[model samples]
Target chain A: MSGLVVERATPLCQLQDAGRFGVRHLGVTQGGALDWVAMGWANWLLGNPLGAPVVEVALGGLRLVCQRDACLALAGADLQARLDDQPLAPWRHFAVRRGQVLDFIGPRLGARTYLAAPGGFLAPAVLGSCATVVREGLGGLAGGGRPLQAGDTLDWRGAAPVAREMPAALRPDLAAPARLDLVVGAQIGGFDSRSLFDAFNADWTLDTRGDRMGVRLQGPVLDYRGEGLVSEGIPPGAVQVPPDGQPFVLLNDRQTIGGYPRLGALTLLAQARLAQCVPGERLRLRARDADSAQREHRRYLERWRQV
Target chain B: MNPRIEVVAMDALMLRLFDRIEEDNLPWLLAARQRIVEAFGAALLDLVPSYTTLMLHYDVTRLDLAEARRRLAAALDGLRVPEDDGGARHTLPVWYDPRVGPELTRLAERGGLEPADVIRLHSERDYRVFALGFAPGFAFMGLVDPRLAAPRLDTPRQRVAAGSVGIAERQTAAYPLVSPGGWNLIGRTPARLFDRQRDGYSLLRPGDRVRFEAIDHATFLRLGGDDTPLAPTGRAAA
Candidate 1:
């Protein structure tokens, strides 16, 4: 089978798609590309489905050797990717010769980079998804929740189309001091006025202890006077405040249910941008109405459809 | 009665039926889940039923926030509890010994009860599976006998064995996978709470009723139970 052989990779490198849905009720979390916007753009460049499985390389350190002539798309963070000693940039699709080497040195700006094939790398689907979620022991090339490893071969079925490039306007600037849009949740009213004021007014720094599950935000100690909460279903991007008052934003791989009070959830676009942020980056939370957030989300999806 | 609706996120809504956890709410929650599924057939991406809430995740492109809420309200306008009894009943056999359950003696001593009495209290009542989270197939069953109600450990153990039957603050559950947990352990069950080969990849579903049946050591081993003692021996606590 025509494919690429993995010569080197870090643990953070894994395959992902839009995510696994209709399975949260079974205690399964939705795992996918943390920077979903990049995943979509990569797939779009290949003329593939926007949610097709792609390799998500975080803090890049991966090297692959093409086994056959293939056209692949690269998008999201500038990982300083190189194709056989030639400098390669993101947001574009290019061709590779058989036995040519592809290397991703390290992150130049963003925290993650996405690589997409024409029909998505071939992998057996588990629970109707190829998205690898290590914690749940599901999905991936082997359908065993394992990340891409050295000596593994990745192949796809579809034929590649004409090369394409993403417009500069569509590309996001993954710079520091990000302003995240947060849609207020039910527990917003229960927090004291001072806590609410501190939540939006102050700047929060991303902590080092972060992963696909969640990221801790270091900032003012907001207070919560709400009664004890019963454990309930948690949505992606939920900014939950524990008793200590420090807030943590739950991500794609977060547990299905939790009991902590939440200020609200970040908009999908904000989640994508946050995925690109490195540790110690400063960010501010901006309150956004659900209607406006939803409208913006629709507009983003429309871009993919038009493409 | 209409449930309180909360905009959990831009694409998610949580319909809260009650503020507190109650077994009686399971039936209503199950019925609400059915109506909500039927109401937003294709638009609904996921529906999660918990202790007193049913969280719905919708595809924003298919339906707007207001339209999703209107459909949910219309479907639940005259919701009725199904005439049929709640969910399926499951009887799980457990090995209640100190070796596998290190916290058994402490929990017994804290409640001023004999070890046998502790097992009896835990096994006597049928608990309802409220929700599943923390790990795949980890069912959060609840409403334990108040006498057996115990608070979670001040510090969670680095690892809790799978199939460990435990209680935490009026809630009872069996660990589906080995994970970090703070629940007070009372026994270990031989039954596999989670199996990937299973239809749903889980032995118990939300709304199911489960009862624990105490079994002898030999019986436990016969059912493929592992009797490896936890790191910290129960004798130390005893």
Candidate 2:
């Protein structure tokens, strides 16, 4: 089958599914879509499973041309997509004619966007996932862990969408700032009295030191009065306080285990919202219990299933 | 037996098990694992198991932490571990040639013995698989001889080829993949510890015993030493 060629690509673009699992004990981190909500909507436009394969483009600069007629969906950040000089919007499905051009520029709001075809993008699964992790040298197109580069082609086999369209209102309005939710972490109380006050009240700027692995929050270096403890299993969203006092919140590509005093993990939904924010964006940390967070999360997903 | 279940987080339960892995709790821990796994039959997340800890993570919306922990505790209380710990003593044949054991001479000097004496001492000591991390099927074996104990290399190599055995901080192990590591190279076994296509991927597990034997490089490359451990082991053509 004809495939989508990478007329222009960047180091950040790669094929991803939900992620590889059951291998953390082996020290393998789960590498998947950073913004899952956008990934799911892109797949939904093509009637694919929520976790179906999709093209994740970070910081834009991606361009593709349809060798043959194709139906596709674009979601997440609006990169000012255009088809042959015609403007295109996000969170909607669109059909391109043979030899048509689909180009992406800078993000108007979010940092990443997802492109999905009818069935899903095709790629070799390494360790049960096509997700890529360059640091670990695992997952990719051939499953040997290579990221997409210019002149590469991506293919799929599912039938094309019967129609093309996404809700106009649903178009991601990321121009407005994003607010992330947080569920209080396990070691939150171990923090010094002053740090706790600053944690919830003060605004922390997102540091430039960011990647799929984690993002360092530049703010008041939190101090822990608790005894020096041994390192433990770290979870995604864990706000770890290094000896230097900086707090780094581990993310999707984090190591299986870590040795640091952790403030706690952010809830899954919280991580999703954070995925949309760019470096330098200001964020405030808040606390929520597990029960209430779970309920809110369940309600959020229920609406997803109804569609 | 239930591991003093605690709510370390909202959607995940922390099972703080006692150390040393008592016989009675092993079964309970295994059972709790089974139940939690079964609960997320369709939406399985990560089920991370450690030496004395097991953490079950799931979609918060699907299963709340309180309910998951309650179910896990019940399973632990009612479960039973098989009488035997699934393990075996492994005697691995490794080639001690300088080309393979790059640091053998250094180890010999450090231990105040001839190169051959160092090999004999290494081949005699029994080791235990204390944990598996750093890579897939990579076993962190413990109790390397005190004379051979050393801190890891100051600068880690970009790639430590798989099957390469090394020592670091009283721990001995083989690299499951070609990854950057700091362990001091001692020798390499032609045996494959991790093969995805194999039935049980990892050859060694926690609580397993390991011993090293001396062999030549020729035997290391040949004898079907590669992964996919299915060939019948015959003593020799003789």
How does residue B7 of candidate 1 score in lDDT? 94
- Minimal lDDT window, size 10, model 2 chain A: A227-236
Candidate 2 lDDT by residue in tens digits, B183-231: 7776778887877566656787656789999887678778444332211
Report, for candidate 1, the interface RMSD.
0.8
Pairs with steric clashes in candidate 1 = none
Residues A1-307, candidate 1, lDDT per residue (tens digit)? 7589999998789989899999899899999999999999999998888898899999889999999898999998989999999988989998999989999999888889999998788888778788899988888889888998999889886885656767888888886569999999988988999999999999999999999999999999989998878889998799999999999999999999999999999999999999998888899999999999999988888997775
Candidate 1: tens digits of C-alpha lDDT, residues B10-70:
9999999987777888899999998899999999999988888999999998999999999
Q: Tell the DockQ for candidate 2.
A: 0.31
Which structure among the candidates has the greatest TM-score?
1
User: Which pairs in model 2 have colliding backbones?
Assistant: A185-A264, B27-B81
In terms of DockQ, the best-performing candidate is: 1
DockQ comparisons of all candidates to the true complex: 0.80, 0.31
Q: What is the interface RMSD of each candidate, in Å?
A: 0.8, 2.8
Model 1 CA deviation exceeding 4 Å by range: B233-238
* Model 2 per-residue lDDT tens digits across residues A181-246: 566665677898899888777788889899998999889878887755432356667778888878
In model 2, the runs with Cα more than 4 Å from the true position are A162-173, A176-178, A225-232, B6-10, B19-44, B78-81, B88-91, B97-122, B206-208, B223-238
